[model samples]
Each structure stands twice: as C-alpha cells, then as structure tokens.
Target chain A: MTIKDIVYIALFVALTAALGLMPPIAFAGGALPPITAQSLGVMLAGSVLGAKRGGYALLLFVALVAMGFPLLSGGRGGFGVLLGTSGGFILAWPICAAVIGHLVHKNANANIWVTGGMIAFGGILVMYTLGIPWMAVVGKLGLDKSLAIMVAYIPGDLVKVVLATVIARGLRRAYPNI
Target chain B: MLDLYTPGTSMLHRMSPGPKMAALAIAATALFLQESLLVTALAVVAILALYRVANIPMKTALAQIRPLMWIFVIFFAVQWYFSGLTLAAYVVLRLAALILLASLVTLTTRASDMIDSMTRALRLFKPIGVNPDKVSLAISLALRFIPVLGRIATEVREAQKTRGLERSIIAVAMPLAIRAIKMADDVSDAIESRGYRS
Candidate 1:
C-alpha cells in the first residue's frame, strides 16, 4: 500500500472513534429506544473507502479497542467488551465495512436509492447475520430472543444507511477520484 | 492528544509492555472464567490497590469508569431482572475488574512503547506478507488521529447547528467526511514529503 492508502485507512479508523462520541439518539418515547451512532462509522468507512481499505480501517479500529483504548461507544473497550454480549457485532465491523465497500465499488455512479439499498444489504444484513447469533451464544439468550432484541435497532440502522449513502454521494461528487 | 499514559517510576510504569499486556490478557480471561463472586470482588480491590501503587489519583481512576457508568447500570438491571441480584453483582464486578486491568496497562505504558511492542510482536508475521513497519505506522497514526477527529466532529456539529441543521445527521456527517478526506490528503502529502515511500 502507498502512503495515501495508509492515510485513508487511518483516517477512517479515527472517524470511527470520533463517531463513538456521539450521544445515542432516542425516539418514539423511548419505546424504540436509543441507538448508537458508532455503527454509522462502519457504514461510512466502507461506503467511502471501499472494500480492502475499509476493512483494514475497521480492523485497525477493533485492534485499538482490544488494545484498551475506550474507543467504543460509552467508552467501553478491551477484552471485557470483546467477550461480552455484543462482541459479535463489534467483531463483525471489519467484515461489515468490507461488504458495504465491495457493493459500493460495484455500483459506482449509482443513484441514491441504489446506494441506500447496497448499504442496507451490506451494513444491516451482513452485520446481523454474524452479530445476532453471537449475541445469542454469548448472552445465552437463545437465537429467537436475541433476534427479538436486535430487531428494534433496525429502524435506527436504516437511518444510518440513508445518512451514509447521502454523505458518500456528496463525497464522490466533491472528489471524483476518491 | 488524549493519551491514557501517565509518566512515573512505579513498578507498572517500569514494566515492559509485552509482559504487562500478556498479564492483562491472562488476568482478564481468568476473571471471566471463574465463577466466584468473592474472588472477582477481591480482584477489583486488588486492581484499585495497584492503581494506588502506580500513583494514579482516585479521581483519574474514577474518570476511567465514568463513561461506562450507564452501561454498567443497564447491564446490571438486565442481569438482575433475568438472573437475580447475585448473578448481576457477579457480572458487574467481573466486568469492572476486567476493564480496570486493561486500563491499568494503558495507564502505565507509553504509546510509543506500546506501538513498538506491537511492531516487534507483528514481526513474526513478516513471512506472511505483513509489513511490520507500515502496520505500526498506521496503528500509531490512527491512535493520534482519534482525538483530532473527535475535535473535528465537535466543530462540524457546531457549524451545522448555526445553520439550524443541528438535528440532522446528514448535515454533520457530510461536513465531517469532507473535512476528514481533506485532512487525509494533506497528511499523506506531508508523509510523502518526509520521504515516506509506503
């Protein structure tokens, strides 16, 4: 990789950390509950950086979390987190980013709707495919229970897909070669 | 900019990064695997004592756990609801012990020393196409950028708020992405100017 590639990767990693600082957004009288802004960072990394580099960026972020930086939402990190209930979701970040990046790369020049679809597929579908089952096993809540709990976050995650799609489209327009 | 390391001459501060990291991993795993609540509570007290030994002030130690207060409360509530008070207490105590142990490592080790140890550890993968130097540089750069990007996020949020777009995620996200990309370009150029080839 060139110096530019490294910078891009590092930049996304930092972006992920920055997004963790965002306060959780609560809606629907707390029935739907608060959803974290951190995962939006994963979507943005992939949508902006593309597969390999995006994956690397998230991988590096996870490594830093493992290294004891309180980079995760609510300033949680370390092996304690990786072994916790949401460990699967945390571990799936790199793969989730790569999946979104790969789809975005294929759909270059696509419209907003198409981009949103790809983000939803890769970010939401791919992530929960790994995350839910892991939550079930780690939390010992069973698959059905885990799915039930995690489903509530989908609406919030969809909002992130839309936001990432819009931001990535604007980014492409501003810097065509990026 | 927000480095957790505190310079000192304590035993933990003098310990090498590799062994300290290893000890943390082992201790954390052991804490999780054990089933005794009393042992976990003792471990928490032990970690606090170690913090005192390392001269980390009580306020600083409390600060480390502050951001996680809500998370702990949620976890405790849920666990209590499902498994009763004892199980909940065990879970939270174990978690606190693990987090404190991990933070202790970061508190004592310099960022450069930690990165150097990682680089040295990664050298074993050199034959598998890993470039230890580049990986180390990327890790360090990512660490350095975390606080900088955090400041940027704050600035972008305020900038969007002035335009009456404070509640819009897109408004803040767009500016943040653009600024981050620009910064990346400038950083890469600076690195290249300094004779960095990769």
Candidate 2:
C-alpha cells in the first residue's frame, strides 16, 4: 500500500478511537443500558469512507478491542465482552458497517437527510437484532426483559441517528471528496 | 471517527474485499461456535501473524491496544470472581481473535473498495423494492461522520476544559448536543445544495 493510503487509514482509526472517548450516557437500566454517541463513529465511518473503508474503520476498532483496548463504551473490551451480554452488538458492528456502507455507496451523492435516515435506520436495526438476543442469553433474562432493556435505548439511538445523518451530510458538504 | 486503515503489501492486503469480508464472517462464526481455549489461542495467534504480515509496528499496534489493558483486567477479575477463570479466558481470547481478524482486514483494504463491494452485495434486496442507492448513501454518510464527530468531540472537550467545566455532564452534553444539532442543519443545507434529494 502507498504511504497516502496508510495515512488515511491511520486517520480513520484515530477518528474511531477518538469517538470512543465521548462520555457514555447510561439510562436507568441496571447493569447495561445502551450508550449514547457510540454509533456516531459507526455512521461517520460508513458515510465518509464509503462501504469498504467504513467497514474497515469499524473493523479496526474491533481489532483494537480484541487486541485488548478499552475503546468501546464503558471502557469495556477483550474477548469477555464479546461473550457477555454485549457480544451480539459487538459482532453486529462490521455487518452494520457493511450494510450502511452499501446503502450510502448506492446513492453516492444523495441529499444528506435521505441518506442519513437510511443509515440511522439500518444501523439501529442491526444493533438491535444482534444485541437483543445476546442480552437474552447472557443476562439469562427472558426475551421480554431483554427486549425491554433494548427498548430503553431506542430514543437515544434515534438521536444518534439524526446526529449521525446530519454530521455525515455536513462532512460531505465541507469535504466533497468524502 | 473510524479511520484506521494502514496500508501494506501483505497477503491479507492482496486478498479481495469479498473474501476478506467472508473470512471475517467465518472467523466470527467459528469464534462463537467453538468455546475451546485452544481454538481461541490459535485464533489469537493467527490474528497476531496478520498484524506482522501487515507490517504494523508492534509498538504502534500495542499502543493502540494498550488502553484496553484495564478492560482485560476488569473482565478477568469480574469473570474470575463471579464466573470462573476458564470462562473469562475464553471470553478474552475469543474477542481478541475476532478483533484481530477484523483489524487485519481493515489494514489491508481500502474504503472505496469496501463501498464498491457493499453496493454490489446489496443488489439482492432490489427485488424487495429496496433502493440500493438509498441504502448505500446512508452507509456512506455514517462511515464519513465517525471521524468528523470524533474531531468535533475533541474540540468540545478542549473548549470545556478551557472554561474549567470539570468534565461534568452539563459541560460535555450540552455543548455536544448543541454542536450536533447545528452540524445536522449545516449538513442538510449542504446536501440540498449538492443536488441531493430530501
């Protein structure tokens, strides 16, 4: 790979890591409630890097965590986190990244609102699909309780979606190449 | 802020995005399916080898992962105290392996290639009346903003620090929300001006 590509990749990785530093806001759920602003990085990764690179960015973060970095929300990482209640969402990241990337890439130059909404929807669903089941299994709670816990995050996630969509649109405008 | 691709001429880098993605899928599946520590160890080794192949400096890679040391400790402690060491080890190794595999894929691949591959993959949904273009747009926006938001967050933090805001919720959340809202509006205008549809 060229030096230029390396620089861009580093930039993306750093960006993803930086997003993790955002303070996590926990709702009134006992052990685990969804963290806010976490998905912003995921959304940005898809929008800016397109599909492949965006996925790569997320993959990089996952890799770092695997390598034992506390880059995830709540300073959680390592294999244990994956096997725990959050494993499902952790596993879903790349899938979500790929899906979001594909959706955004299809309309390379669509307006921000439409693109943002599509991404927000896809990202949230992917997280929920993966997170709910894992929560059920790990927490040993019934599907109903797991679903209820997952539900608490929807409002917050929606906010993230809107924020992600807007920021993505803004970036496109400011840096057309992105 | 998810821009962490490192360019290299490793075999992993030369692999196609489609296969790389498939490999990740396979690896993750295997990770979840098998609960053996031996399997997890092998996976971790394989991941480390990929990092070597990618020529990612060990120091750099470690530095990237260093922050997670506490996480490992906490996880190990919690699992060992509450569950058992075996389970804790299993969890750590499995997650580490998966993360490594993913990072290797990202290090070797390009963002553009990923986007192209995704756009192609989503064609199957067309029969269901899903517009692949719309889907792709959303993906792109999400990917692009990860880093942007990260940068904005940093700026916000620094600004808060300057004001001696002690990193409280109000100090961080208020500005972050305001800035995010303003950013959203700017993005909407940008999209409209660029001929993007609502």
Candidate 3:
C-alpha cells in the first residue's frame, strides 16, 4: 500500500465513525433499535474505497470500538457491546463492506445497477446472516425472532444502498482512481 | 469523546501495554469458560479491587459500565424467563467482568501505545509481503480521522434538517459522503505533493 492508500483507509474509518455520532435516522426516543445512518458510511466505504481498503477501514473502526471508543451507533462502545444484541452486526460490518466492494468492483463490466444490487445483497443479506444468528445466541432470542426484528432494518439499508450508489458513481466519475 | 484513560501512577497505569493487554485477554476468555455466577461474581470483585488499586475513581468506574446497565437489565430479564435465574446471573456477571477488564485496559493504556503494539504484532506478517509500516500508518490515520469526520457529518445533518430533508437518507448521506470523499481527495493531493511514495 502507498501513502495514498493509508490516507484513504484512515479517511473512511473516520467517515464511518463520524456517521455514528450523528443522531439515528429513525426517531424512536431510544426505545427500540431504531435505524442508524452509520451503515450508510459502511456502504459508501465499500462503494467508494473498494474492498481491501474499505474492509481495512471498517476493521479499524471496529477495533476502536472494541478499545472502548464511543464510536458505534448512538455513541455506544466498549467490549460489552460485543456480547450485546448488536455485537453480531458490528462484527459483520467489515465482511459486509468487503463483500460489497468485492462484488461491485471485481468485474470491470459491472455497472451502477450491478453495484447497487450487490450492495443490497452484501450489506443487507450478508450482514443479517451473521448478525441475526449472533443476536439470537447473545440476545437469547431464537433465530426466527431475531429475523423478525432484523426485518425493520432492511428498508433503511435499502435506502442507504441507493445513497451509496449515487455517491459512488459521482466519486468514480470525478476521481476515477477511487 | 469518552476519553477513558485517566492519568495515574497506579500499578495498572504503570504496567507496560503488552502485559496488561495479555492479562485482559486471558481474564476475558476465562470469564466465558466458566458458567458459574460464583466465579464471575468473584471475578467482578477482583476487577473492582484492581480498579481501586489502579486509582480509577468510583465515578470514573461507574461511567465506564453505566451505558451497559439497561442492556444488562433486559438481558437478565430475558434469561430469567427463557433459561433460569442462575443462567441469567452467570451471563450478566460474565459480561460485566469482560467489559470491565476491557475498559480497564483502555483506561490504563494510551491509544498511540495501543497502535504501536498493533504495528509490532503486524510486523510478524512481513514475510507475507505485507507492509507493516503502511498498515500501522493506516491504523493511526483511522484513529485521527474519527473526530474530523464526526464533526463534518453532524454539520451536514443539521444543514439537511433546515431544508426538511433530514429524514430522507439520501439528503443527509449524499452530502456527508461526498464531502468525505472531497476531503479525502485534498488529503491525497497533499500527500502526493509531499512526495510520499510506496
């Protein structure tokens, strides 16, 4: 990796953590697990930074969270969250970004629509695959119940995928190297 | 924002980052292996004792574990219903112990020092053609970037709210992401002009 790569990875990690500091998109007064916008940053990382760098960026973000930085959604952090209901999704984020990047960027012929589709699949499908199971095991909800709760997260993520696609397209157009 | 590491002269604070981290890793895993609440309760007591020895104030200690209180309550209630009270006690105690241990490490060690340890550990991967220096640089960069981007994103969110577009994911997300990329480009250009090559 060059100095440029280092800069990009750090920038994306900061971007993701920054998004976490913003208020949650869904305003439910902190009762339910309302939708957070940080996942948008994860999608943008993969879509804009590509797989390897994007994955590294998220790995850094997660590492900081594990280190007790209040960088997660709602400004929550520390190792306890790894055992919390959200731990699975938190752990899955790096993989989700990598999958999104790999699927969308691997093929030279892949178009905007293809990228959008892959982001949805990778960010939503793959994330929940790891997340729901972990939620069930840690939160002690059965797999079926975890799925039911996770469904609420889909619409927000789909919107994020569209947002990521537009930004990624614009970024690639302006700075093709990304 | 929760800058946890308090300046102190206690043994924990004086200990090298590597050994403290190793002990934390061991204690964290051990809390999981044993299902007995008795063991976990004892472990929590030992951890609190260490905290006292470390000069971490009770207020600071409570702040560290405070956010977890509600989650612990909910999980305990769930465990009580689905499993049993004994299991619930064990689960909560184990989680508390692990979280305290992790927070203890964070409070004692500096972030830069942790990054140094990370770089040192990654140096073992040099034979695989990976650049540990670059990886370490990236790690440090990520740590520095968190506050910068957080400020930018919050500003964007407020700006979007004025236009009543805050609820629309694209309205807030687009500007935030676009500005982040723009910032990245400027930084990349600065790095290039400084002649930093792989």
Candidate 4:
C-alpha cells in the first residue's frame, strides 16, 4: 500500500470510532430504541474506500479494540467485546465492509438503488448471518429467539443503509477519485 | 481526550503491556471455560483486589463497568429467565471480571508502550511481506485521529445547526466526510514531504 492508502485506511478507522461517540438518535418517538451511527461508518468505509482498504480499516478498528481502546459504543472494548454476545456482529464488520466495498467498486457508476442494496445485503444480510447465531450460542437463546431480537434492529439498520448510501454518493460526487 | 491511562508506579503499571495482555487473554478464557460460579466469583474478588494493588481508585475502576451496567442487567435477566439464577450470576460475574481485567490493562499501560509491543509481535509476520513500521504508523495515526475526527464532527454539527439542518444526517455527514477526506490527503502530503516512505 502507498502512504496515501495507509493514511486513508487510518482516517476511516478514526471516522468509525468517532461515529460511536455521537449520541444515538431515537426514532419513532422513542418507541424503538435509539439507533447508533457507528455502523453507518462501516457502510461508508466500504462504499468509499473500496474492498481492500475498507476491509483493512475495519480490521484496524477491531485490532484497536482487542488492544483495549474503549472505541466501541458506550466505551466498551477489549477481548470481552470480541467474546461477548454481540461478538458475532462485531466480528462480521470487516467482512461486511469488504463485501460492500467489492460490490460498490464493481459498479463504479452505481446509483442510489445499487449502493443501498449493496449496503443492506452486506450490512444486514451478511451481518445477521453471523451475529444472530453467535448471540444464540452465547446467550443460550434459541435461534428463533435470537432472530426475533435482531428483528428490532432491522428498521434502524435500514435507515443506516440509506444514510450511508446518500453520504457515499455525495462524497463520490465531491471527490470522484476517492 | 484519550486519557484512560492512569499514572501510577504500582506493579500492574510497571508490568509490560505484552505480558499483561497475554495474562488477560488466558485469564479471560479460563473465566469462560470453567463452569463454576464460585470460581468466577473468586475471580471477581481477585480482580477488585488487583485494582487496589494497582493504586486505581474504586470510582475510576467502576467507571469501566458502569457503561455496561444496563447490558449486564439485561443479560442477567434473560439468562435467568432461560436457565436459572445461578447461571445468570455466573455469566454476568464472569463478564464483569473480563471487562475489569481488560480495562485494568488499558488503565495501567501507556498507549505508546502498547503500540511498541504490538509492533514487536507483528515482526513475526515480516516473512509475509508485512511492513511492521507502516502497520504501527497506521495504528498510531488512527489513535491520534480519533479525537481530531471527533472534534471535526462536533464542529460540523454546530455549523449545520446555524443553518437549521442539524437534525439532517445528510447535511452533517456530507460535510464531515468531505472535510475528513481532505484532511487525509493533506496529512499524506505533509508526511510524504517529510521524507516518509510507504
């Protein structure tokens, strides 16, 4: 990787971590739990950085967490997070970003629908595949129960996908080479 | 902005990050592997005692667990409902011990020391075309940029608020992304001009 690539990767890592520091926004008059902006950072990482660098950014983020920085939401970090009930989702982040990045890169002239679809497929479909099963095993909840809990996150996650796509699109227009 | 490392001359503070981290990993695994509540409870007590030994204040140490309090409560209630009280206590207590032990390392170790140890460990991957210096640089850069990016985010939000677009994600996010990308390019140029190489 060039120096620019390294810096870009680190920049996205910080961006993702900083997003965690933003207060979660409650939607639907607080009927649903507040949605975190951190994962939106993941979607942006993939859509903007492309597959390899985007994947590395998330890998670096995870590595920092393993090294005990309280970068995760709510200042949670360390091996405990990697081994927690939400471990599945956290572990899936790098792969999720890579998947989105790869698809977005392939469709260089992607419109809103294409970008949103890629984000949803990678961020939701790929993430849930790993996160749900892990939660079931770790929490001792059955697969059905774990899936049920994850359903609560769907609306919020979809909102993030849309937000990330719009942000990515704007960035692309502003800096086509990015 | 990232002053989690508490200054001290205690044993834990003096201990190197590498061994402390290794011990954390082994101990955390043992905490999960063993199914005995008594063992886990004793581990919890031992971790608390270590905090004292490390000269870390009770409040500072408790701060590490406070953010996760609700998570712990929800987990306990769910586990209790599915299994029993004993199991629930075991799981939560074990989790608490793990978090405490992990936080203790961060609290006692300097960020530079941790990065140095990581660079040393990563040297083993040199045979695979892994550049340890670049990796370590990226890590430190990411660590340094975290607070900067956070400040930038706040600045963008405040700027948007004046235009009555503070609540609009697009307004805040678009400007933030553009600024961050521009900053990255400037940093890359600055470093490159200073005789830095990839």
Best by DockQ: 4
C-alpha displacement of B159 in model 1, angstroms? Answer: 6.4
Residue-level lDDT for B86 in candidate 4: 95
For the predicted complex of model 1, DockQ is 0.58
What tens-digit string does per-residue lDDT give for candidate 3 at A109-165? 678788789889888989999999988876556898678767767787888888888
Candidate 1 Cα deviation (angstroms), residue A175: 2.4
Model 2 chain B weakest 10-residue run by lDDT: B63-72
What DockQ do the predictions score, one after another?
Answer: 0.58, 0.07, 0.54, 0.68
- Whole-model alpha-carbon lDDT for candidate 1: 0.83
Expressed as tens digits, the lDDT of each residue in B1-198 for candidate 1 is 445688899999999999998898788778867889899899999999999999999887787777667556766777688878887788777767777778888888876787778789989998998798889788878877887787887899998889999778678777888888998899999999999864
- Cα lDDT tens digits, model 4, B149-196, are 878878999999999998887888889889999999999999999999
- Looking at chain B only, the TM-scores across the models are 0.83, 0.72, 0.89, 0.93
Q: Residue B140 in candidate 1 has what lDDT?
A: 76
Candidate lDDT (C-alpha), each: 0.83, 0.64, 0.78, 0.87
Per-candidate TM-score against the hidden true structure: 0.87, 0.54, 0.88, 0.94
Question: Could you give the CAPRI-style class of model 1?
Answer: medium
Residue B36: error of model 1 in Å?
A: 2.9
Error of 3 at A121 (Å): 1.4
Off by over 4 Å in 4: A26-34
The C-alpha local distance difference test score for the whole of candidate 2 amounts to 0.64
Off by over 4 Å in 3: A25-30, A83-85, A107-113, A139-142, B151-169
- Model 2, residue B70: distance off in Å is 3.4
Error of 4 at B55 (Å): 1.8
Name the DockQ score for candidate 3.
0.54
Error of 2 at A175 (Å): 26
